[model samples]
Target chain A: MTLKGILLSASMIALAGAASAETRIGMITTLSGGGASLGIDVRDGFLLALEQAGRDDIEIIVEDDEQAPDVAVQLADRMIQAEDVDIMTGIIWSNLAMAVVPSVTAQGVFYLSPNAGPSQLAGRGCNQNYFNVAWQNDNLHEAAGAYANSAGYTNSFILAPNYPAGQDALAGYKRFYEGGLAGELYTQLGQTDYAAEIAQIRASGADSVFFFLPGGMGISFLRQYADSGLDIPVIGPAFSFDQNILQAVGADALGVVNTSQWSPDLDNAANTAFVAAFREAYGRIPSLYASQGFDTANLILSALAVADPSDEPDAFREALRAADFASTRGDFAFGPNHHPIQDIYVREVVQEGDIFTNRIIGTALEDRGDAYAAECQM
Target chain B: MSAILIVEQVLNGLQFGVMLFLMAAGLTLIFGVMGLINLAHGSLYMVGAFVAATVAGLTGSFLLALAAAMAAAAMAGAVIEMTVIRRLYHTDHLDQVLATFALILIFSEGTRAIFGSFPLYLDAPALLSGPVTLPLGIEYPRYRLALIAAGLLVALGLWLLIAKTRIGIQIRAGKNDREMIAALGVDIRTLYTFVFALGAALAGLAGALVGAIQSVQVGMGEPVLILAFVVIVIGGIGSIKGAFVGALIVGLTDTLGGIFLPEFFKLFMEPASATQIGASLSSMAIYLLMAAVLIWRPTGLYGVRA
Candidate 1:
């Protein structure tokens, strides 16, 4: 072997030998670029959970993915090969999760996803080593569809960016909404202008509109929609009306209905504590993404307490599947696909004094698992 | 679609077109006069938006925020031209591209550092917040209509400044033969600085105007920058008239193609697959247009003959 290879092996042996029971956790999340806010919240929430648990045996290494799939793959490789991490988590985007999760799981490392539960991973690609703390990608959209039906909407206009998640969003909505679609338009991903789409919506004579444009695209759409003078009631996944986004959207998003598995105002003992602690720590309201990260960390800690990852791999997997920890989303449980089966609630955007945040109005889908779970052989 | 819907979509196309023209005009001017391919032009646009958002937040005045945006971007452009871009003028295109690309990273990080990751809030002025009825009984956003008018006004002003003023003569002479202008005792360096700053101001104006309707966030300018480059390329490099025409073409093709292509395909194909194919094709429509333009008249529709 070359001297470099020999030295690396020596260090690996030393690291392995030195920490008999220490677990290394690798976190790959978007901490820069357009999606940085989500990552920051996730990281902060994860760190907050660990700090509260006081788990010094768990060594967590965080790296910025820069919202790119390729960067996430590289970080996963480096963490697995060099750091010899026993657990991996903290991928926020579905595309990046798809890029990294399968390979990491195949390599015998446990991956606990804090966010991004793409349907592929929840179905045919399901692995024993993978667990998702967040709801499946289509869960909120499905809830939106259910809520729309209950609200007695007969005609709805739906739109989303043309991508995998966008397709999932529309399909999820269509699965439950029995109403006839007034229009369905798939604009280019990252498209900021929605004037043409809005014009079509104005002309379509729809009773309601549903969209799934996340991040800045959502902000742009909401602003333009407000300016368009079209008064059709609008609904979407909570991604568009999240705390961080609502601040950017200003007053335009007020009174909009959105569906989510968790909200800052979700009334529960765990959620109340999480919101308080998160505000104390970050000086901002926690988003659903943050709650997901917190729950992911708590689940890991719960599993670690029950069985060791390196020594009792099967037991650790079973422990994760059991999901014994108290979730910010109360009554969380894993479905057959290891994705969360939880109540998805409908929320309304409201201004509490100065800050814009969501208030839970009603449960759209209670104990809702994913449609793809039956496809998973596992 | 009804005729009224078509009219509204066309108006939307014109609004988007004018915004693209604002960005492309500045980019074309800098390239035309200085022959500098500045990728950092987008960063300047971002700076303008962020500055506008901050000013509007603090002062609660949209017009003042717009003025601040222009001043900040122009000052930034002048400084960058003097300090960093000035040296690269004598270098090759590769070096210029590399340096300006690095500027994009620096500016993006710097803006993020100051503004944080969350997008800042900016909205249209109260006077232009809602829609207005047009002659054809079509309702459109007053803010977008104002954008089209402002863009056309700027285009007219730019045309007048270039065609009538003495400084315009110097700029034209510099584009043709810089050494000749320098020999004629023109302060060519100052002229270059002024031109860069002027280009920067236009981009800033576009950013502030568009920022009212769009999210004012980091890395917001890069996408528009790509479209602006496509516009300058299709309009012909170093041609102002080409940039304007090219921007309108791109904007209309994109907006109309997005709305119409799927409907056209649904006549013969299943609606689901038709939409999938149509959406995919419309995203590529601009690139295909650029390719067609290049093939027909290499150097662009209005590119000066080599």
Candidate 2:
């Protein structure tokens, strides 16, 4: 075709496409480097949910953030200016979320968090355009704290990486723990060696150890802790005991209690189907991150079915607030801060045949909202 | 802290220093002889750990894994030296840095492509898995003790090889006057390749030993690589002795600072603020030490004054 004819046809096609009201979603997530697995799982789970829903009017654009907050911010800008997405989601880290969410939401774009749920977003900084399908940052740690109280531990030693999420972890544990702290230490983030920390734990005379080291830091700490021959019981959030990390940790992670809002074996139709479908699709057990991603996608789809996101903003926001979706975590609902107010269960890591996974032992917290909800104006 | 705890912490510092020396030793040696700055040294370390983990998974033998780690890393180093690095030897530091930085990306993505993003499992030998009580009634992991011994042994071997062997003579000669030695009929290229491979093997050994204790994941070497750079800087670049002393000082400062800084601050400040300040300061302790060393001795502790 001639140049002018081609240009005319392209503009016509663009106009035709715009008439259908397709919801454009921009996903900026960690896809390479150290934290790639989490982002990959989240993307896979999100894609799986979208596939299951079979939504034809939704368009998604994915970009790698490289686990860097600056890169995430840049991608958010590009997505907003260049792609003009109506919604944003799929940031795996709290710091990255903190960097991108406020600006995106302030610009009148809806952001549905898949994994990261920073306290700032759930507190006074909460935005009407922002929704977190996952529990607040402190939810699982608070559940672990409650479980620690019931386990009858009078004294406990706690540790976490020296970062915002780590501070939140320690504070969350302290909120409901009701135990005397024998020690409270913050190690360097991404620190591989825990000898100094382990020595302190051994010398602290604490009854048990509660730590919030996540990802490879958790694996290293557990292996080194085991080798140090400290027999003290350990408790943590599910990021450490998740299916992906558990295999790397091997038998050492077995029988360790962890808390989370969802599990592969939660004994619900939604969860059972999610697990089966996820395994068939990805050929591995889905992690809590994957579940959150799945839930986030389904939440979007549910809202999309009732109203166009870019056209009727108020109605779409209400539809999202209603959360009319079958969550893998049964009976999921949003709190005042637009974060989940849901039951957090305690799970013990166990081996089934060859694969290592978590099994729900008991409920730790029932229908728990976040501590920061009171601070949220929205 | 109790006497036993202090002793244990000291041992931990020594072990950590020894491990850093393995990484620094090769780095210093390579810089000394080749005058090439290789940022991809860390990639070699990661390659070592990955190879070790793969070998261990297949054989279930820790010894075999270590051997394989050294072999694989040395091979990688030689290949890198010949293909990409050989051309950069005559270039400026910026060009070398850019080229090697590109290599880091390539190796990281390549490893990720081969082994998925998940961390690999590599455990210490069963015999060395538990803690052992020292003479001072301090219980420490036997594997760490082994690590210290192995590091010292390697240090000794390096010292002997450099001080007593013909290749060591050529290496020393090359560092001083490469053109002179080359004109004297020593194949400078072969010597450079050999020195690089040897350094790579040491780094590999360190990676394998440390990987058993830590998670064997992609980009695991970068943090240690930064510390290794600090070590070589403090030890004086291109000086193995300097690297050794610098490594020990860094390790001790880091370990002891982490444990005692908070306590020191708690004596005056409130507990919470003290903990925060102490943690922050402790993380900066090594860098402070490096600064102090640099201020006192611009040439580094053992660095030869140019």
Candidate 3:
């Protein structure tokens, strides 16, 4: 045997193999480049949950996916092969999740997703080992559509990058939006300059604009849109104006409405404690990604408490299905497809002191379920 | 589209073209004068943006931010030329490309280390934030109009400098016969540094100006850099006038093609499929234009005979 392998075996035997009994959880999330802040929030939230639960027996390994599906797949393989983790979770992008989940779950490791519930996973591709503690990708956009309806906008300019998630965003919005679209443009992925798009929107006579350009793209679009002097009211999913990016967007994002499955102001004991504790610990308000991470950790912890997943696989799956934990978003439960069925809230960006933050204006969709869930035989 | 709408879209295209000229001017100059391929030019553009954002945050003056961007990028370019770029002068194009590519990673990571991963904010001045009515009753942002004016003025100034000044004569001589210029009592090394820094400063100026309206983040320059490369190729590598014409062509083609192509296709095909094809084609329009230009004139539209 190699010296390193022999030493590892020696160490493994010396600890009475308490490590063998411990439930190792592998978290693969985007933690660098454009989506770094979102991944950092998820990691911090997950760690905070583990800290709060004060679990000594659960071991966690974190890896950054760098927003690349190939990287995520490689990390998942290492986690399952080398670390022998019982559960793998914490992917933020739907594309990466779609790549990593299918193969990882086939190997018998419980795959709990903190975010990114793609439509494919909700339907025919759904696995017994997979559980999504987040809403389907289209849920928030659908809520934005419902908000557009209630806000009484008759003509809207809609645009998203031409990708699967981007297509889902527009389709989700159109499902509920009663208004005629003045313009429906699919921009290049990672398009920064929006002057042409904005110019077209101006002439299209749209009373409102709904876009789904997330992260740096959203910041660039909003800044240019604001500069273009088009005073149309803008709406989008929460990913467009999240806490991570609001600082960069500045006043351009103010008064903009977005939809989310959870907000910091939910008026629940668990949520209040989470928001306060998260701020106290991290010196910033928790984002929606953070809430998802926190819930995913607690969900796994509850299952760990009931039965050791390594020893009692069936009972462990049953316990995870029970979802016996209070979520920061209040009462949360797993649907038959193992995705969260919960209320999505509409939030408005407002100046909170020197920093920009969101306020829960109203609820848009209550107990909304995925359209793809019916196709899942599970 | 309404006549006014058409005019406005055209104006938008002009604005985009002008900004691209600012970036491509420097790139073409460096390539012509030094025969060096700089992949890190984008990183320099990003440097200008980050420096501008930091300074604007501290000073709250857009003008100061612009000045700082120029100085910072120039200084950085000088340092990079002296330390790393000068050594690569004797090396082939492949070596220079690989070295500059490494610099991009270094610059991006180093900027991220200082600025953090989050984007920085730089606001347009209050005076230029609002819209103004032009002679044609077309309302446009005063800032964007001012950008077009500034870009044109710089182009004019560059034209005068190259055609009328001592440094311009030296620069042209260096591009024509570097060894001859060096042997003729000119400090060719210093001249190359000056040229690189001038290019970097122009890119920085573009970055600082656009950062006011766009997100100031790491890797912001790459998209513009790629477009600038296409501009240089289309214009003719060593020609400033070519860069200007090429930048405008690319800018207009990108902007106008994005708008009208889909509508044109929608006349015959399903709107959904039309948009798909239009977007795909428009995104590829400039490259296709570049390829066509090359097919007609292999070196470029304004390429000088070797």
B1-306: candidate 1 lDDT, tens digit per residue: 788888888888888888899889889988989999999999989989999999999999999999999999999999999999999989998999999999999999999898887777687899999989888778899999999899899999988988899998988898889999999999999999999999899888889999898878788899999999999999998888999999999989988887788889999999988987887888899999999999999999999956
| Inter-residue clash pairs, candidate 3 | none
Candidate 1 is graded, for docking, as medium
- How do the residues A1-378 of candidate 1 rate in per-residue lDDT, one tens digit apiece? 322333354346435543543888888987876577788788888888888886657777788888888999998998898888899999988888999999999999999999888889999999999999998889999999999999999999999876667878998999999999999988767677789899999989999999998777787888899898888999999887777788877677889999999999888999999999999877899998899899999999999999989889999999999999989988999999999989999999999989889999999999999999999986
Stretches of model 2 off by over 4 angstroms after superposition:
A1-21
Candidate 2, overall lDDT?
0.88
TM-score of each: 0.94, 0.94, 0.94
Please report the interface RMSD of model 1 to 1 decimal.
1.7
Candidate 3 chain B: worst 10 consecutive residues by lDDT? Answer: B1-10
Model 3 TM-score on a 0 to 1 scale? 0.94
How does chain B score by TM in each prediction? 0.98, 0.98, 0.98
| Interface RMSD of each candidate, angstroms, one decimal | 1.7, 1.7, 1.9
Share of reference contacts found in each model: 0.67, 0.69, 0.60
lDDT, model 1, position B9: 81
Instruction: Report, for every candidate in turn, its global Cα lDDT versus the true structure.
Output: 0.88, 0.88, 0.86
Return the top candidate by DockQ.
2
